[model samples]
Target: MSQPQAGRGTFITFEGIDGSGKSTQARLLAEHLRAQGHDVILTREPGGSPGAEEIRALVLQGDPDRWSAETEILLFTAARRDHLERTINPALAVGKIVVCDRFADSTRMYQGLSRGDLRATVDQLHSLMIGREPDLTVLIDMDPDTGHARAKSRQTAEERFEDFGANLQAQMRAGFLSLAQEFPERFRIIDGARAIDSVATDVAQTVSTHLSSVG
Candidate 1:
């Protein structure tokens, strides 16, 4: 089902809808690990690597109309390949624990939920193409509509994905929750409606527990 699909070191991912507080909490997790004197690498999908970042702008800013879902998937996979080869894998090779804000999971939920057909193949490719997954994933689950509002409240200007409808966002949220259910050991879903520190604490604890188990 996966290509090689295995590797050295632990990969940790952060997932959620637009306003799920994943980025902030992912940083907190990385900091917490570093405080424990563990090496931690922080990165993100579709952008962390230089090449990936270039593609990121195209995917995020390019006209969604001119692009087919298949085209979008290929672009994302291309970025992922660049990210893994240039950034993620190298960091892992050095034995550092990586805390990534989004990864293959983002692809699954966003692309899967948006497309009406050929969804399963995209899902299959996501799991199969990537050779590594986070040893733990902290999903900040929230109502996509509320999440969109929250995201808008924070941003000065919205990105392309952020401009989508509540319905699409809801489907994405459903996709994320379904993914969590399928990978019990890999996902730790956290309530994201509370204050930031409260959410951070939950994320920190989950990372702590996963790290302890690994150690």
Candidate 2:
């Protein structure tokens, strides 16, 4: 992975199947960094900026078949472009550590691989519009059944993806692990099946090592 430009802030993203606890981990990491006197911004994809948030509602709610795989990819890419322009890049330019709940990698799995074999289209669009990748990505690996149950228990309108069923969750879990291998330089795998505190400890340690090495 390419290093961030000099004077740029670190970009850290969390990724996993729904209910894998990535969002919680992202929040905790942001808080941890802030308490340690580091400037941090906690955000999430599909909805970091106002415009992107609007798009987020479109893609995250509604029936599972509301949008075609191709359309979903376009929607996600648009949101990401807006997010980078309005939120992520500005923060990084100012040297604030940005902790994001999910990034392009989620799209890679959900829209690119899962919906169909559109990974190439996803990559092409990504390179042309938004070319940034996270400095570090934490993958919270979890069992599909457990993650699916947790996601359903929430009963949120954004359960569109979770509505795909446990099979998709299993597929997503496998896809994420494969993605980690594909980007070993910036990806860290954390076992999310453990207690919340234990998982957070592992995440914290992993990020601390990354920060120290980069510094």
Candidate 3:
């Protein structure tokens, strides 16, 4: 889909390695913004709208080898397209802030970093199908060991990605940081090892600063 027109709304996405508290932080930021009197919609990738949720199960479940990295990229892009069409675009069109837990970035980190050679393919597919990006991406940065420990504590069918273990998490963390460097204007990297409330406070401040600058 094409990028939203200027002033349509602000799109914010939370991105990080698994267990980096990005999901929780995304939710908290949504609540914080709502309290500030902004209309906000809290959503997630791979499963924001109904059609994409069905795609979510297909990509996230089954064996790790269920799909090749290249195929997985297609699935994620398809899901993202559906999500943008059915949920995100509508929310943004109405001038509501859309806070997403993950976006095309996750596809880049997971498919690109894991598969190594497919990173270029990921970028091309993203440009072809999911060209738009969040106006702000809050990347919660943390050590891989800590992230793995926290991720292991949470049991879910979505353990597929976490199964790659700490080494991959470390690599993905590096990949995420590199992405932040590549997209400095749109990225706000936050130290996620601090207390939850502390991270949330910083996130709020960051969003406030971006909003003010945009206004």
lDDT per residue for candidate 1 within 1-215, as digits (tens), equals 33433447788999999887889888887887899898888998778899999988887773446467777888888888778877788877778888889988887777755765656867676666666667888899888889888776775432667766577778888889999998998999999889889998888888778778877
Q: In model 2, what is the error at residue 53, expressed in angstroms?
A: 0.3
Q: What C-alpha lDDT values do all the predictions have?
A: 0.80, 0.93, 0.90
The CA root-mean-square deviation of candidate 3, after full C-alpha superposition on the true structure, stands at: 1.6
TM-score of 1: 0.90
- Looking at model 1, report the run of 10 residues with the lowest lDDT sum: 1-10
- Give the TM-score ranking, best first: 2, 3, 1
Leading candidate by lDDT = 2
The collision pairs in model 1 are 11-134
What's every prediction's RMSD, in angstroms?
2.3, 2.6, 1.6
lDDT of 2 by residue, 98-188 (tens): 9999999999999999999999999998887888799999999999999999999999889999999999999999999999999999999
- The alpha-carbon lDDT assigned to residue 176 of candidate 2 equals 97
Off by over 4 Å in 2: 1-7
**Candidate 3 residue-wise lDDT at 183:** 95
How would you order the candidates by lDDT, starting with the best?
Answer: 2, 3, 1
